[model samples]
Target chain A: MPQLERLWNEFKDKGLHIFHVESQGTSEDDLKKFCRAKGMTFPQVMGQGSFSGYEGGSGIPYAFVIGADGKVIWQGREGYHAVITEEMAKVRFPGLGKGSVAKGLEKAAATFAQKNYGKAMADAQKKLEAEKGKSSADAAVVADAEHIIARATAVGERLQKKAENAKAEREYAIAMATYKILEDGFKGQPFGDNAATALDAMKADKEISKEVKALQQLDAMLAQLEKAAADEKKKNLKAFAEKFKGLKAAEKADQMAANL
Target chain B: MRRLGATVLSAAFLFAAPVLMAQADLKGKDAPDFKVGSTINEAQALSLDECRGDVVLIKYWGVN
Candidate 1:
């Protein structure tokens, strides 16, 4: 963790964002205390099932380096500082790294890469608006700002179209996934609201609604079964088994419940 | 609660918490985006998708 702090200090000026996520089941206060004691000042957020989905072994101190293209460039359990340093050095923000306007542009570029198109566009516009009538050597900065705005706009449109097409085709899962990207990735934007509406409609669909309920019921039954087995409360086991018998994975659930 | 705590602690220390020496399956794939409450500023939330374009290093850690 200290090594990560070192990396963040060294490369933060160069557009490196280090985010520390407290893994599931860990208390936020404990994580905050740890960070404070370590004198770490980078952004820290709670992680929800991020590592649980990792195909690699689930362990503490896992790190992933995501590039401007929104793809994972490097991921590992250790040596993140070295990998991130090398990656950061390779990024060349033309006409950035100096001046307030350039800094704003740099931030805009970073926001654009993160798929926060609306924020990126708004920031770029603000920078450009501030630079109006000021004849400084900010041509390159202006050009990059314009480019970010255009690219963000184009990407936002593409994502919207993709989601719409998926919904039209009745590919409910794909449509929901795409809308989720727009909703969460571009929150506060019009597109995000649109995605939310689409998601609500998708959830209202009868087939999808039924399937989701079944999954929820299965999860509840499994939880109850686990609790009953742990407490050795055999009386409740029969009721759990009866409930499991009606679920999709009835065979496995029934088998486990029967053992209780 | 005790059992859950034990399971969580075991998982946290599982595999020696080693720096992943092996190549990650997610390398080169689109990083999964997430939004969670921020400790730095409780009123604000942090999202992975908002870090786009910068070199974002996400460290998953446990206090235990």
Candidate 2:
């Protein structure tokens, strides 16, 4: 809050416009209360009603810095952060702090590739914090966070795949969660196009890829046995028999029955 | 009643506090409008629409 206040104070003379986008649910009341509390002298919209145009293709807190000709000088993070601010910083300031934030994030990504998670996270977090009214910092943080997770997960899956112990469904779930976070976080940014791309990849849920199908089949068989054991332990013998009979792998079913 | 009065007074002050500072000039274009609770001599809302005819200096002073 102090950071936000300082930003407003510092940039007031620079024709900086701050628009708060409101949506339905818990965040709605928060916006109203924030408006009242912040003494926002500028225009704010209720967002749900006639204020939709201000929302652009996305929703609230998504700011745009427009040039005098009505062209979007900066569109907030469609890929990673607030779209308008990101676009604006690159277009307007070019080589300002926002640019540095972008460069720092790129460097951090390189560092992460070298197995320096601590340094990467620190560098990314610092850039995110120092990123003033500029949207680049926000985009950098979002991208870096997702990049770190995605890279780490990919490496884990790669090692597991090489060892013939990969769990396809587990990989899918992790990827899905990563994409979901990115999707939610990029709401007001101009990075909508990139977000859509990432979302599509996540939604693919490629569990049946040829390289993973065997592992998935084995995992399914193991899971069935585990469930049977759990049911048996719970004294649900009838359910356990039903589950054991339903096993798709005949070998696993026979093995389980032989054990029983 | 006291709580209600305090709430109203606080809201009024919050609403008026920024206005007390020099507002950015809104000379032309649509003047933005904002509303607050009841206050003495306070317009029900502040709108750039009201300052339409003259040199409406609309100043944007805040984070972008």
Which digits, one per residue and each the tens of the lDDT, describe model 2 over residues A1-260? 34433544544323233333334433434554455445444334333333223333322233434332223334342321233334333222211112122444667655543444345545655665566447544665666455544443443333333222212333443444444443343333323234457557545645324323433554565555564654453343333435444333333334344444
Question: Which tens-of-lDDT digit does each residue in B1-64 have in candidate 1?
Answer: 9999999998877755563443357888987775555455221114564355557777776677
The local lDDT score (0 to 100) that residue B12 gets in candidate 1 is 74
Q: After superposition, which runs of candidate 1 have C-alpha atoms over 4 Å from their true positions?
A: A49-56, A92-260, B1-24, B41-45
Q: Which ten residues in a row have the lowest lDDT in candidate 1 chain A?
A: A92-101
- Relative to the unseen true structure, what is the C-alpha lDDT of residue A28 in candidate 2, on a scale of 0 to 100? 38
Per-candidate TM-scores read 0.42, 0.22
Every candidate's DockQ is 0.24, 0.03
Candidate of highest DockQ: 1
Segments of candidate 2 deviating more than 4 angstroms? A1-4, A25-32, A35-43, A52-61, A78-260, B1-64
What's the TM for model 2?
Answer: 0.22
